[model samples]
Target: MEEKKLNELTNEELLVLKKKSKSTKVINASIIGFCVGIAGYSLFVAGITWPTIFPLLLAVIAYKYLGKNEKAVDAELKSRNLS
Candidate 1:
């Protein structure tokens, strides 16, 4: 049995991988947002009132921001390798 390497992927396979990675990122972002919002709402209801919504919103924003940073870093590394 042999293991397949990612760089050995065909153009079509690469495209599929790219699309899958994008969708996964979007889905993950959305899930994190929902969890944050819901947890915030719960906290507010529990009388932790003032800070609840702020924390939740910040969590969602931070998660997406970190994801974007990761993608940028990945792109930079790939470009450097190609050059």
Candidate 2:
């Protein structure tokens, strides 16, 4: 699917995108927190091992996805001269 540029989005579309971006940010933070908790629990149960690192990896992926969404929102805001 073709993606529209931030500058090309209508105000209504921008509002939707903004809401989605905020939702994604919250979800990503939750994922990071959950992963950290899992990692800590794994460490306590199994010591420093591969399983302990897996959740950390997931957290990193979530963080990167979060950054991408945030950048899109920032671009939209910048295009609208709101930032």
The pairs that clash in candidate 1 are none
Stretches of candidate 2 off by over 4 Å are 1-4
Cα lDDT tens digits, model 1, 1-83, are 01134445455654555556677677767767776777767786785654666667767676866466346434543644631
Q: What digit string (tens of lDDT, one per residue) describes model 2 on residues 21-68?
A: 777777778989999999999999999999899999999988876677
Candidate 2 shows a clash count of 0
How does model 2 fare in lDDT? Answer: 0.79
Q: What is the C-alpha RMSD of each candidate to the true structure, in Å?
A: 6.8, 2.2
> How big is the positional error of residue 59 in model 2, measured in Å on the Cα after superposition?
0.5
The candidate that achieves the highest lDDT relative to the unseen native structure: 2
